[model samples]
Target: MKNELLQIGPVTIYGYGLMIALGILAAYMVVVHRAKSRRIDPSHISSLTIWSVLFGFIAAKLLYWITQWNNIIEDPRLLLELSGGFVVYGGIIGGILAGYVYCKKKNLNFLQSLDLFVPSIALAQGFGRIGCLLAGCCYGEETNHWLGITFHESHYAPNGVKLMPTQIFESVFSFALFFLLLYIAKRKKPDGFVASLYLLFYSLGRFVIEFYRGDIIRGSVGLFSTSQLIAVLVFLATCAILISRWIKSNRVSHT
Candidate 1:
């Protein structure tokens, strides 16, 4: 994996940053396209997207700092030395919060908006995982399996050793989920159903992935990594919400 994918005179294009940009663009396009189909105002989506991304980055960095608190306290300079450190779940939570606030302020249907955007989130995450692979950030533990990959010039991952390539596995899973969500959307499922499924499935996938994650700097709680803990919470919360909504719908239908 080459971090510095291209260099031109005074400018350099890094693989991680480039993939992130592409992910954002791709996600936006998907949102706009879906918005048109749903007859929702694309302008609102534009503004919401901006707010979500800005807050998402902030939250991701904030959570990363929190996880690395002890290290930062020991060596304050380490914070300045590190160019990048972010937790994906933090970004997801921050983005959802931002979108919720935006929907409330605009007086829009929040569930409908969620249904429109979650698939795109999965798509963006798919791209972001590829970025992680290229930058070698969320790498996997050493493995001698045929699927193992070795990175020679990774900024974070151990070089010259065969690794599990969990990044690719997650990327593939995200992409598959994106398509599945889109298919579920076309079936016109209940409002928030798609979003709930997204959360449930993503949390399960992430929790399982944490086992293979090699980076121990991400911190932990009890027997689980920070992400794993968050995933479990998200999964349970989504399940509870889904069950409540189903019961409420049933009651309304009966009445």
Candidate 2:
């Protein structure tokens, strides 16, 4: 894996950072296009995006610090390290929370806003996972299969090992989910259905992916990894939301 993708005198570009930049740009474009279709104020989206980017970075860094609390206790300077160790779920949570607050303050329809962003979020995740691949951050376990990817002098994964290309697998899955969500959006089922389904599908996929994740920094409790625990909780929450919506619909129809 190569972190430094390109470099010139007094300037350098990192693979991970570049992928993230591209992902954000692509996601914002999708958001703007979708917002126009939904009749949402594009200016509101622009403002919310500023909040999302700020809070997402902070949350990602905060969670990473929490995961490495022991090291930080030993050396506080590690907290300022501007490279690697970010948790994707943390960023999503932070970004969503920021959006929620912004919507509330702006008196916007939360579910509709979610509908506009979920597909974009999925697309962004797909690209972000490719960044993980290039940085060798979220690597997969060893495998003897020819399809496995090998790295040399990676910052995280073991070098010279044929690992399951889990990053690529997750990237493909995210993209598939993105298309599915977008297609479902076209059907216009109900408010929040697409968003909830996005959460359910992503949580389930992430839970399974945790099994193949080679890194130990992901933190675990009992038999479940941190992300797995989150996935289970989010899955249950999504189920509750869907069931409640169904019950409400039934009651409204009966009335």
Q: Which stretches of candidate 1 lie over 4 Å from their true place?
A: none
lDDT of 2 by residue, 1-255 (tens): 798888898788988889889988999998998878778777898988889878988898888788778888999988778776777788888988999999999999878888888898899899999999889988998999887999996888999999989899899999999999988998867778888989999999999999988887777778987788889998998899899989999999999
Q: What's each prediction's TM-score? A: 0.97, 0.95
In terms of TM-score, how similar is model 2 to the real structure? Answer: 0.95
lDDT of model number 2: 0.88
Residue runs of model 2 more than 4 Å from their true location after superposition: none
lDDT of 2 at 171: 96
* lDDT of the candidates, in the order given: 0.92, 0.88
Error of 1 at 120 (Å): 0.5
Output the lDDT of residue 69, model 2.
88
Question: For model 2, which pairs clash?
Answer: none
